[model samples]
Target chain A: MSALFEFCLRMGDNTLVLGHRVSEWCGHAPVLEEDIALANTALDLIGQTQMWLGLAADVEGQGRSADDLAFLRDAWDFRNLLLVEQPNGDFGVTMMRQFLFDAWHLGQLETLIDSADDRVSAIAQKAIKEVTYHFDRSSGLVIGLGDGSDESHARMQTALDLLWPFAGEGFEADATDLELAGAGIAPNPAGLRAAFDARVEQVLQRATLSLPESRFAHRGGRTGARHSEHLGHMLATMQVLQRSYPGATW
Target chain B: MTPIAQVWEWLDAVPDPEIPVISVTDLGIVRDVDWEDGTLIVTVTPTYSGCPATSVIAMDIETALRDHGVDRIAIRQQLAPPWTTDWLKPAARDKLKTYGIAPPQPAGGPESCPHCGSANVERISQFGSTPCKAQWRCRDCLEPFDYFKCI
Candidate 1:
């Protein structure tokens, strides 16, 4: 596969997986407001996935649509970060995951707005606006819950610790990333680390949450070498309708 | 040939699927209208990326034009110059207020309850029933309302 296609998949799959995970909270969130917010966030991410994967299909010249790319692909073919595919353990865990991802996602999109490729830049331009709101909401909730009470604080801290290792994979660059970065089509994921760290540190401090001091990065999800077992189960449910019917449409 | 101006008038009559009080054109989503090689091209932008009404709005536009006997119609989605609440027409804002949905404000939240016209409104949630709205409640009237959130 071409590096551009691979890059687009990485971008698309992250949103698709995370969007699905967030959507799982639609009726189950702790409160009505939270339920609506989570659902809205999920919708924005899924919409972005359509754009990125649509571009990926166009670049591949394979006649595959975005829906086909999303539903037909198995876990092994996905290029999302392990952090996004991780289970939404609890409300706190989900928010922590979202906050971490949004931090990096915001920075990445900001840089992407200046991408050498117009399509990539255009997608970023559109996505950044929605992502800015996502980051605002997620980070605000992180601070609110983390500083609220003893129980909330403890859960937020635990979530941060549990999800931190997976966060590093977002910054790890591979050959596809290198080629895109070299061509000015995209930023090297590694270069986004500093901004990510600064944002995380600032938010965690305000949230009264401690950042886990582990730099032990998880590898493989973005590379498609391996994924967490959670991914397969998630995909099974996500792709079930399409997989069963082959070409179902509303 | 139907004048492009006539096409705009027809589109202006098509109500937004989500906010029926305002037409898609009133929402400023109908970016441009022109004729290209005998095909009527209507360019639109979505209020929010995940807005479920985008496809519906396009269909509504097409159906409205087709009813006017303009068969060669093409609806194109544009992303550049992303849609903002600022694009909402002044008349649309008045209509939204009359419909009990607060129009967007540059202050990032509703300035007053659309129903009570009281400045005692508080945000209930940053999100609402639709992607483009937020839930708010009037402190004086104790009635909850949807506010078109600024992007």
Candidate 2:
């Protein structure tokens, strides 16, 4: 695959997987309002998934469609950020995961708006609006739930600590990433690191949650070199209907 | 024998699949209508990235034009300068209010109740039956309505 195609896959996989995680909250969110909000966010991400993966297929010059890329890929073959595939532990954990991802996701899209590749820029431009709203909603929840009750506050902090390590992967740039960045076809993940960190810190402070001091960072998932155990199980469930029905359409 | 102007007129009659009260032209989704070597091209922008109605709108545009005796049509979806609720025609806003949906308020401003024309409205949910709207309730009239959210 071309570097650009791989780049698109990395982005598409992250969005599709994360979107699936959020969709799991559809009818199960703590409140009706949260249910609607999560579903909306999920839909937005899935739409992004379609755009990115569709581009990936086009760039690959292969017959593969977005559905093929989304459903046929195995856990080890998928290139989503490891952070996105992590289990949705609880409301606090889910919100914290979303908040962390949204911070980086927004930064990535903002920088991508100027990509030399018009297709990439166009998709990012359309998606930035939706991501902006997702960031707002997730950040607002972080502050509200984090500062609300003792249980919420503690859970939020715990969630933050657990998810913090996974965030480092979003900013780690590989050789292909650097090439894309050099060509002005993609944003440098490394370049977005500082801004992402600042935003996350600001939101954490307002939520009264402290940044986790852990310096250890887990790598892989960009190229699907490695992934969390949660990914395989999730894929089994998500791909079941597709694998069984093959070519099924609503 | 149909003119390009006639195609535009036909498109003006194509109602949005989600909100039938407003035509696609009035909803501002139809950005441009032009002809290319005897083919009709209609440029459209989706209100929200995830709005499921966009495909339906494109098909509706095609079907509407075809029904008007236009043989060839190309519906293009553009993303730059993304669609905003502000594009809704002033007249369309009135139509939305009459249809029981609150038009989007100015950015960061509270939405007014469509039922009672009061500002005592609180957002009940960030999403409604569709992606383009939010569920809101009026404190005055105690009626729940859909508010076209600021994109």
Candidate 3:
């Protein structure tokens, strides 16, 4: 696959997987406000996925549409960050995960606003506004819950510790990333690390939470080398209707 | 050949699917209207990427144009200079307030309750029933209202 197509898939799949995970909280969130907020965030991410995947399909010169790319691909064929595909453990965990991802996501989109490709730049331009709102909400929640009560603080810390290792994969560059970065189509993943770390440190400090000492990075999802067992289950549910019917539409 | 002004006027009659008080033109989604050869091209920008109303709004535009005897209509989606609350027409802001939804404010929150015009308001949530709105309640009136959040 071409580097551009791979880059698009990576961007699209990150949002797609994370959107699905957030949408899973629609009726299940601890409070009504949180439930609505999660759903809205999920919607925005899915919308971005449409643009990214649509571009990917066009670049591939394949007849596949965005929906086809989203539903037809198996877990091994997916290219999302391992952080996004991890389970939403609890309300605190979900917010922590979102905050971590949002920090990096915001930085990524800001840099992409100047991308070499007009399409990539346009999508980023549109998505950055929504992601800004997402970051605001997620980061605020992380702070509130982390510093709220003894239990909440403990939970937030645990969630951070659990999710921090997965965060590294987002900054690890592979050949696809290198080619895209070299071509100016996208930024090198490694270059985004400083901003991500700064944002995380600021938020975690205000939240009264400690960052995990180990930066031991997890690898595979973005490379399609391997994915956690959770991904297969998610894909099974997400692609079920399309896989079963083959060409169903509303 | 219909005049572009007349086509825009017809589009101004198409009500937003979610907020019926204001037309798509008033909502600032219709960015341009012109005739490209035989096709009537209407450029639109979505209020929010995932807004379900986007497709409905496009369909509504098509239906309204077709009813006006325009056969070849193309709806183009524009992403650059992304849609913002600043695009909302001033008249539309009044319409939104009068319709009980607070208009977008520069301060990032509702200035007051749309119903009671009370300045004492608290945000209930950063999100509401729709992607473009947020939930707020007036402390004075004790009524919850949706605010068209500044994007």
Question: What is the Å distance of residue A118 in model 1 from its true position?
Answer: 1.5
Residue B43, model 1: Cα distance from true site in angstroms: 1.0
Question: Residue by residue across A166-217, what tens digits does model 1's lDDT show?
Answer: 9999899888888999999999989999989999899889998888877998
Give the residue spans of candidate 3 off by over 4 A.
Answer: none
Which rank order by TM-score, best down to worst?
3, 1, 2
Clash number for each model: 0, 0, 0
Model 3 pairs whose backbones collide: none
Give all TM-scores, in the order shown: 0.98, 0.96, 0.99
DockQ of each: 0.82, 0.72, 0.87
What docking grade does candidate 3 earn? high
List model 2 lDDT by residue over A1-250, tens digit each.
6899999999899999999999999999998888888998899899999889999999988799988999998988898899999999999999999999999999999999999999999999889988998998899999998888999999999998899999999888888998999999988788898999899888888899989787577888887898989999999999999999989999
Candidate-wise lDDT, in order: 0.92, 0.89, 0.94
lDDT by residue (B35-151, candidate 1, tens digit) is 999999999997787788999999989888999999898999898877888888899999999998998899899889988899998988999999998999999999999999888
